[model samples]
Target chain A: MVLEATNNVLRLDANFVDYTLVAIYFVFVIGIGLLARRQVSTSLDFFLSGRSLPAWVTGLAFISANLGAVEIMGMSANGAQIGMATMHYYWIGAIPAMLFLGVVMMPFYYGSKVRSVPEFMRRRFGTGAHLVNALSFALAQLLIAGVNLYLLATIVNVLLGWPLWVSLIAAAAVVVTYTALGGLSAAIYNEVLQFFVIVAALLPLTLVGLHRVGGIDGLVDKVNNGPVENMLSSWPGQNLTGFESPAASVIGIVLGLGFVLSFGYWTTNFVEVQRAMASNSMSAARRAPIIGSFPKMFIPFIIIIPGIIASVLAPEILALNEGKGDGNIQYNDALLILIRDLLPNGMLGVAIAGLMAAFMAGMAANISAFNTVFSYDLWQQYVKKDRPDGYYTRVGRIATIAATIIAIFTALLASGYSNLMDYLQTLFGFFNAPLFATFILGMFWKRMTATAGWAGLASGTIAAIGVAVLSQDALGPLSVGAIDLKGQGASFVAAGAAFFVDIVVSVIVTMFTQPRVESELKGLVYSLTPKEDRTDPNEKNLPWYQRPVLLAGISLVMVIILNIVFH
Target chain B: MADTDKQAAKEKRAIRAFDIRTIIGALLGIYGVILVLMGIFASDSDLKGGDGSSTNLFTGIVLLVVSAFFLTWVRLRPLLVPEGDDDAADAHIE
Candidate 1:
């Protein structure tokens, strides 16, 4: 990371009370781990919360698991760089896909009782697709986990002024002990706690920042009259998309981010799918992502608005980002600058705790998911089969420790990025976009053979990486400048390329190969599975408001309204 | 069969004793109390060129209200462990 030597790096500027609040928060996190330890006995409990969490709990955990580096630092960075156009990430990019996961995808995931998303792939397309998915998914989790761990320790380094390694080790120890002790239950419990704590921490920063910028009207007036054009509007997003033409910008965001990237991420990423899988019943499982969608659509207000406020209040932020000023505060520091300027000590402590909670929760989610796939999909399926249930649980704990150790090194790789989201999006485009393509194609089209499944996954991943490498400034210095797309334009184009390649390859491969018999495709494929099989019988008696379809419909409408209003 | 049921019941009893909502409620209550106290006692001289709005006090009250809701919900619908293998527990909404 480039040290902004002229300016302090996210200094809490704390006193006695601020440290006290953060310490108390840590104690509560450890306490929750101890409470959850009693619930774990079998590997199932350790990995999947024994599939016994309530919808409300799982729903909150679904969103909270996501509220890590991306939601805070990444979105705020987008908010600073692109202004109102950043809302695309939430309203169009996330909400619809999340609802799709709830109403369309969760039945296949939960009803079949697969332990992980890759396990479902195994059942559908045999071991070839399963192996490809498991290896890629495991690798993706570790790299992403490293990102979360690095950011968490970065906050600790700034707040306490500790050496980077010392902060890294301390942060890792807290997450690993809790995750190892109680496993998924512990992580889920802490995630719910972290959710509330993070909200408490951020809500005040937003309101206070808004107050400083005068109000909503004042913010609009200032932005409308500010230095840049197209910052106030979310549509076309010319500034964000790096397109001179409005048409190209709109198409890029909708097809690249909205259709391909969003669907790929929300539907197939096991880190998210695992949260819904932990729900006790089919109905609760389906409802998890939908319940999450309610808060998911509205989070940009709390997260991005603060960044907009920071950019206005601190003119040096933009000046430094554009290399016009001698000072060195990047756009990634937008939220930190707000915290420093707007908040007093009591709330400052809360804000610091919130940033830690966000990073920790994100790392814990990744570590927990990594351990599960490592133990079940990689270890048990491949290395040591027929092990006793208790033996696998032990392996999971060991895997948690091993993942933490590996993540310490991986964290170093992430330090190179000025804006963390750029790195994160490139990773997601490589891993998730192709995986989503293979998953959706196989799930809907029964003729998609096992050979096609693995082939599409491999080829699509290569294509995404290939496109990203060609784009300007996407892979940092590794980019070749063959492509003119800038910033997240490379990510969007890469995701689109991955999706297209996966589909075309799968179709061509399927024509030359044999598919499984219709009888074998029952719950895994769309057309072959009966409608009744998708829903739990108990869901019949659920209230209208609580029904999955009704909830998803409501969520879809609300997100559409938000998009139009913001547009 | 009887022995298995007895074991399941005992395990369920242990689980019920450590209700997750209770932990969340208690922690939120602690943070809320601390913040409320600080909001009352902390001098306002620190805020830059102050408007008198108490961000700490308001945030504390909201946390307390949310904490109360969680505690109340848990009291109304406590966890029930069904008489079956752990794989097939009855799904109940909290």
Candidate 2:
């Protein structure tokens, strides 16, 4: 295979047809956004799609919104480096948390009628807790949006030889225009479209790559013969060092990713939950995440397998340099290299369209969540109260534009980071770890006081920052030990530590403080809410296979089988 | 009797045939069909890029089938207007 090298920079041989196909994708996405404009008459419609979307639409969009450029590029990079252990992000990290959101938390969110996740915090805890959580969430969304934009621009610049600035500006303009006009309905609809585009784009690449490398067995043999060994194993030991970090033991993966980070993101992060909240009914809302879990189980085959194939096909490009300068193969370019080397012109255009769609869907998801939190949680609540529905709707539109502009600058700043996924998860550790602790204490325990809630949130966040600082070797005086805990392992350790600290602080404070009255606690806490209110009214009417429990059970069984086979 | 009339009007307004699913299904089917055609008629040069294979053609078929399934699902169980405004109340919470 001949790889095009121009000035030592590898570029995909994209022609006029490829560029035309990509342009068509942009027009189609923006058109969908404008088409949905008719549906956005009220603030509720703008932010939550009038709460009328079905389970399938919401479910697909739920997973699609999370499948950003970072996920496609970053996970494949991990797959190349660590092999099958990358599946943990899907199976252990994502599936359980998604199920918990559907089965346990959706009732409180949908039943109580909170517009956003921070509002849930306010209703459960008090203003101080709400503001802290809301501000952190809003900031995190912007940063994450910036990261997505940065990754997309970098990949485009490398593949198409377009200037990074042009890519960033064009992407921002398309996403902001559609998002501002269409609202959440437009975002969700486009996400479903983007989901199909991504799958269509990547599945072909995987098939072609596998065929070139030989079939599944050929892939296995090629990968084993390459520099990396045990590329097919899911377990930590046995030559598979779990996500390229020695510190990422089985326990660390379980607690950090599976419990704290995953639960924090899937359950409380407004970006994902906003999709479920837009469902037509409480039953649909509960089922949305559950339905999403079905596709979430099999996504690794398309995404991760390409990276593994690249490890064997282009080891020179996949190689890393210890120095801070240029490496033999930039790890993040795994997906791009596969496309450049493998796909034909017509098919290449389709893959590029899929890549762009994934980037736009991710940016739109973050921007949508940012606008909702800013308008409802921050602006309407504090900046101006009791505004007309149209007023908040206007604010949401303005917020989308503002957030996009801010994200552009943030993306520019994010160019300094070497690994996109590591930067993202570390940020998640800073906010999500402590945030999940607060949510857990408030949800299951009725006696948990507002004072305790704020304390746990504040202290838990502080603990995470402290652990991160101490884990750094450069900060010698601040370093706790010589152990250099990095990657997901460091984030997991910080989150696990914060989880316990938040629990301890919350428990002690709740014991000393007065609990809210029964009336105040109704529908908010598990113990106080009636059993009938908690149960889905349509559960008994549906067939056995259609129920959330059975769906979750089947998904878990499949995950278990994959783990066993891969292990 | 006036309340009943008002309720009837609201229900009538809510009973529209078009929904998000219809839009998703139709758009995906259109795009998938176009892609499949392009893949099948790809030039010799294009075929060289993919090693004389039809990966795009197969993937496009899969997308087309999935899109049809979504459309069929909507036809089987169409959305109806709920009797009361539970969502409206939830949406307005301070």
Candidate 3:
């Protein structure tokens, strides 16, 4: 029964036209890769687009690189489980941090001329902090890359009615081909392409889903009348945060998710930052995240709302949610169920292609980031110090292939969870939360020593892992259940704990150690950097709306309005 | 100086030939045409999801419009790879 229902949802009754559309999309994806390969003459070109892409290109790639497995599958799963509360992941969790990245952090990153995020750590701190960051970041990318690969494989399993292993290899091969051939240029260009394909596919699905459910007001009624209550509105979101009181839940989400997890992921993570760094000019780099935030604001309407629609609209999902349906149908299958039910041939093919694009975009991001760090940070800084530029580019290509293969194995690990978001957030809490803490303190406080940097990062990560383990069932069977926290709230609390511990350790360690010389800290430390160094020179020439500051201000206002309306 | 000028010319040509806007326009245009064809020749069963409304037709037309806009934007205000070497871009790093 479970197998049959899973099959029913997985295999859309797609005809020849649908297959042709998907085939065309695939051809375009590979063609873009081949085209990008022609331009890859140096290591910089392969890894960083030679820092020569325009603002709009990088901006779209910045968001599209993120729209992969996490946004479409994980967030949609969150929407299916929690309803309106999922809006917070965008309004509360992403927009402000994105603006902060554009306004405050991009200057430091682009200005430093660092090859990668961990490389920035090397400049600000030292080798100790750099090694720790590089290793952990590489691991995180592999783990997350596996999640995207596994989901892509899962879709293939259903679509072709093939086994999981075959599908996994097939999906991994596609991402590997483009990234290995063209490197970051391939990934970025294809990402820009995938972005449009994704919107084209998902937007239609959302509109059709809303139509099926009689629009937003109608969805609200169905939800209220259905098995769930208070889903149409976003407020405390008790179920989402796993906190008992409304106030506590709100506090947890704001502090943990909004401030720590969100900023940590958006600002510090190289996957998104690499896109900004690829910009030809500092002004363009500054504008990247700000531009991304506009579309980022409304993405939840299409991605998350469709999940909500599926939850109430699809009988299979409703049954699965109620614990009476097929065993294989979980909240993660929410978007798939909607696609299978609502879309007909030509659009169905496009949706399948979109899903494929999303998964590849996500996995490609992780792979590209992984290879860059592996070659530039881990290899160049430590292992192979004086290799030719061409050698490092070769190393990068080899690393891409290596990461993709390892991700195939990691994909197996990702299959253990039913809802992928919880696991993803847990990993973010461990890596990003502590990293953000160290970054914020070191950037603002000149007194933060190199000793504190590594020490704080190491201890904070341990603290987060410890917290997640202690929380009952949050990490699955290994959890001690010593803490009362459960659900996504545990990750939030873990991130908060990680942030606090890192800050405390950094400060305590800083008091004893000798601070870096002020002379050396210029441009690396905020107060020491010149006013002119941080601001773009050409920015004044642009119109009011084109400027980063004004664009960010407008974005902040729009997000606030969205939050209130949803509440 | 002559070599730099030659290099800059080659770079500008690369930018124009492989402009992202052109790729996006071409892909979207192709998909749009295919989708429009599907919409026109759609069977009765295809309209079931849209409650007899041709969703394919509507989406296809919308995509075509967006595709046209992208292509026109490329023609009117093409992406400019700033002339001269990117040494100035790096000079800002300090």
Candidate 4:
């Protein structure tokens, strides 16, 4: 049944005109990268754009890099299946994360002048923490890169009638070549162009799609009348997949996402930190987050709303649609379905461009970050310590190519995985959540000694991995009910468990361990609150935690009002 | 450092002024506040959920007020040019 439906839908024919245009766009992106090659003479330039990016450019590029093909489908699929609650991840989860990051952590990061998040980890903790962070981050990058490639290939295959591997190779080649040629500068420049194209295509389609589905009012009615409506409205109902129960969702929304996720990703993630590293000044870096937060406020209206409308637009397919046995929608096909059925002639080409833009941007960012880690953190730190800057630049470009090849193969494997968002969250649970806990403790807690940092990381990792392994039936045949909630419950589990374990371990270890030397603490603490160094060098200071506190409060009020009302 | 060096630094301040980037950023914050307001008032008529009642009005008012804080701050903050080389900024406390 699924195959037949796929066969019927996959009959989309891309002629010479469509292929020619896509090919031209690909060439243009590559050309831009090659043109930017002159700017990328040193390793620093290649990896961090020579720190010349202004506020708007960095802000736009930051959002564009994260809004790739995988995120698009994952968000849309969530909106389609889960109802309005999917909106919480962005409104309640991501927005607060961005603001707190801007207010609390940016000063430290911008002030310290660290090349990467893991490099900062090294200065604070030790070589050991740096290596573990570098490795785990690399692994997370691999997963995201692979999924991004799969999304690109899947979209092209479904929409253009190309073979999956053919689409994968073609798409990967263009991004890899450009990224290898120009590095971070090329990636940022291309992201700006791609961001425009993505917004142009998506905004129109969202409006038209909503209009076709009876506008926002009609969409609300259809969803409210649908089977998934109740699940979609509030979280952790029968159809609710993530965020545990309503109580947990409320608390998690308030505490976890409001504080932890915002601070963690914005402040510590290598990819995000890399963006800020390219800023022209501390002020530019500060503006990056504030400017970046603006796009996210409007994105859900275009991205997720279309999914809700899609459910109404194609009620026939959704209702009678026999998805995979596990209940995963062929989510990669959702946007393609919308494009083929709804859009007019020229617009189809535009939507195709938009999807390609998203795919390429994501793939390029992942490969670039992966290469950066391999070159700077791992290679420079451990392998060959004294290479020339130009040589490392060349090697970083080579790592770009290598990372793409690895992702291409892994993407093929990921084809068997179900749903983009769920897969992303599950992977984050095992990897990113632990990293988050360790980074937060490492930053905010003054008495959080090295032993505390390592213990927090170790406990978080073991607990998360244990849950993941146990959920996977690794401990023998469990009752169906025992593992039934693993799909949606895993993220909340990992997030809560990692936080608690890291806190416990950090506190317990800190009791017996000494704080970091005063000199060592100077970089992080002084950076956070500039006045601290002058006020009293010996007195441990917490930066105006009040700013993040205020910002977080504002963010919460915004999310509550937006989600309950607009979403 | 001599008086000459200080004089040189003072003369090199290249038009310390707010520009298009600042305006654009500040405007974007205003737009975010507008969106929150739209969400609140429109919620009653909006399909998503929530009763169109006094509670929503109250929630909406509170959110608009909070968003106003960000909006006002973005507009009010002074533009500060970098004090040295871009790469030097990276070595601020290193």
Which sequence of candidate numbers ranks them by lDDT, best first?
A: 3, 1, 2, 4
Error of 1 at A104 (Å): 0.6
Q: In every candidate, what fraction of the native interface contacts is reproduced?
A: 0.34, 0.33, 0.26, 0.05
lDDT of 1 by residue, A1-567 (tens): 333322355666788888888898899888878877887756777899878888888999998998997578878877877788999988878888999899988998887778899998998898998987888888878887887888777767766687778888999999998999989989988888888888888887888777877888888887777665667789989878888889999999999989999999989888888999999888999999999999888888989888887777777666754557554566777888787777777777788888898899999999999999999999989999876577888999999999999988887766655456356546655878888888888889999999999899888988998898888988777789997887777788999999999999999999999998888889898998888777888788999877999999999988889888888
Candidate 3: clashing pairs of residues: none
For model 1, fnat equals 0.34
Question: Lowest summed-lDDT stretch of 10 residues in model 3 chain A?
Answer: A1-10
Q: In candidate 3, what are the lDDT values of residues A230-271, reduced to their tens digit?
A: 677788878789798999999998998899989998999999
Candidate 3, position A350, lDDT: 83
Candidate 4 local lDDT, A123-188, one digit each (tens): 777787788888888877887888788778777776776788898899888888889988997887
Cα displacement (angstroms), candidate 1, residue A234, comes to 0.3
**Chain B TM-score, one value per candidate, order as shown:** 0.68, 0.70, 0.67, 0.34
lDDT scores in order: 0.82, 0.79, 0.83, 0.64
Candidate by candidate, in order, the iRMS in Å equals: 4.3, 4.1, 4.1, 12.6
On lDDT, the stronger of 1 and 4 is: 1
Q: Write the per-residue lDDT of candidate 1 for residues B1-94, one digit (tens) a residue.
A: 1346446534753554677788878878877887787777777886543642277778778889988998998899887764334443321110
lDDT measured at residue A145 in model 1 versus the true structure, 0 to 100:
84
- Please state every model's RMSD to the true fold in angstroms: 3.1, 3.9, 2.8, 9.5
Native-referenced TM-scores of chain A, all candidate models: 0.96, 0.93, 0.96, 0.88
Off by over 4 Å in 1: A1-9, A321-323, A413-428, B1-14, B51-53, B82-94
Stretches of candidate 4 off by over 4 Å are A1-8, A11-21, A231-245, A252-263, A320-332, A416-428, A469-484, A526-529, A532-560, B1-94
